[model samples]
Target: MSDFVARRPIWSLVILVAVALLLWLVFSVWTPGMEAAFGRKRVFLSALFNGITLGALYFLVASGFTLIFGLMRNVNLAHGSLYLFGGYLGYSIGELTGSWLVALLVAFVVVGLVGVLMQVFLFRWMEGQDLRQTLVTIGLSIIFADLLLWSYGGDTFQVTTPDWLSGPVTLPLAVALRSNGEAVLMTYPLVRIAILVGAIVLGVLMWLALNRTRVGMLVRAGVDDRDMLSATGVRVQLVFVMVFAFGAGLAGLAGVVGGTFQSLQPGEDTRILLSSLVVVIVGGMGSIPGAAVGALIVGLAEQFGSVYMPTYAVMLTFVIMVVVLAIRPQGLAARR
Candidate 1:
């Protein structure tokens, strides 16, 4: 029991459960009259679901950011650019093919390839040169942002949820809740559920891939000591390139997934990137669980802030970030 308590993995699980419980308690108290006003319990439930969905999307982007930053020590100012470009590509592809799934896949692969090429052509050369790489990537971000603005004309574009997911799902608990002083509310958008499911699935897959797979082992080893791995005859450069590519691919996938729910414009990239950076910083660099925790907190804060305090919603994330950092500069789950 003591060994288990001391283990990071076990503590991580405990933290997750604690956070979930806290969220449940907070929402239940804050909206005690929700059922009376809305005539349904699903409204409050959906808000929690919505928070998870948003967190899932943030996890996708922030996971990538964490990985890249952890291994390469690159701040990756261009990450947001990749995200924007992915949305544009996915939108364009969907417009042509009229299939959202195909567009998502195409966007992931294309953006991933771009990441690999970027590493190969630019980052690889600047390895060990942190300042130069940061400046160069910042320049690249500006260039990409300007090009996207010029091409897309700053217009907001929407990605339609598939027909199958267009309607609501009457959750299993809808009818059961009526007996517990809760009102019946059955209809909930299926798309939102899908997003939540997808994000959870992705998070699990990422964890397994990182913990149980050979590639993941290489990644962990690389993060710990790239020089040692290279000295051991591992193709460290190739691994770095692949890691960067995978990270970028995850970001692109997020863009495509999130774009379905919210319209994308040229400016959204910056908005999301800033949020993602906050998530990364608050969560702790290179920690997947940290990213999830940070993202959920940020997401819920955004949701609640928007509903109850619209003006503070914008500043809410930064405020939390500052508090967290002040208390723990290494982040809430900082390993170092």
Candidate 2:
């Protein structure tokens, strides 16, 4: 059985695909019932869109966590704090300059710098010390959270989008609906579309960098075996620093993008941090593709669960994590 499972995971893949198809079939057939229950067909579409958007944001944040943990083996618990800091800083800058672009750039650079500083002053010394790294980062997160609350207050704040992305885009639904006997159109926020596009682009770029570039080669080698990578006359520390900074920059960028749609609150740091952890765990620690897939699953699960099972919505992510762990304790794509 073990040999067969190892030789042909094809059955597992097939089962997954079949399950997805079954779900789709069931949902299609049950659309009318859902509309009857929810009083609208648009609810599903709205939830789906929200899921995609939230998933993109989760991917951005988790990608950074994946890189830092996957390669450096550093458990930076304060990652979400950096995300919140970026959002608040971006919001303040945007308000002052009245330019979202500027805020985005500043937030990315500043938060990235902060990440680099944290690594140099705090994490660099604690290399290979997981316990120390975790505790220190948690401490930093707490300090940052308090500082932010004192400065920004407990009031929730949201970033303003550019004029072009301020409205909704209408999507034509070609399929005839049972109720209308005609095609229905759907409208979704333009920003959501932009977020999805941005995530795809970022994922592609990261893939290329890891697979096609020299630096990416080094990072991959490091992930596989750090001591060997260092012995090969390569500056592994420098690579680690650069990767950490880049990951921090990605987190900051996500903050600005997410803040535009979702309000930034005092506890958002912890919330996003928890979400990123789930993404990493479900996707596999340190796997970029895994993070993307995990983020999408989480996003969809959260949104759809909220609509269909409001009472159980919060437990959906935990359920997914538990299921994934039970089936593959190492995650969907654990490092071999």
Predicted model with the maximum lDDT:
2
lDDT of 1 by residue, 1-336 (tens): 456456767676887899798566434433446556644444455666677788888988899999998899988888888888888888899989989899899989999998998899999998999899999889988998999899989788887677887987876444224446774545667887788788888889988998999989988888888899899988999889988999899888888887888778887888888989999989998888889889988887787677657788879889999999898999887678
Candidate 2 lDDT tens digits, 1-336? 477568679987786798797456434533556557855656766787799889999999999999999998988899999999999999999999999989999999999999999988988898999898999998999999999999999999999998877898877643226575665566788988988998899899999999999999999999999999999999888998899999998889888988999989999999999999999999999999999989988999999999989999979999999999999988886755
List RMSD in Å for every model shown: 3.7, 3.2
Model 1 residue-pair collision total = 0
lDDT score, candidate 1: 0.83
After superposition, the stretches of candidate 2 with alpha carbons farther than 4 Å from their true spots are 1-39, 174-182
Among residues 3 or more apart in sequence or in different chains, the pairs in candidate 2 whose N, CA or C atoms overlap within 3 Å are: none
All models: lDDT? Answer: 0.83, 0.88
Best by TM-score: 2
The runs of at least 3 residues in candidate 1 whose Cα sits more than 4 Å from the true structure, single-residue gaps closed, are 1-43, 174-183
Q: TM-scores of the models, in the given order?
A: 0.88, 0.91
lDDT of 1 at 195: 82
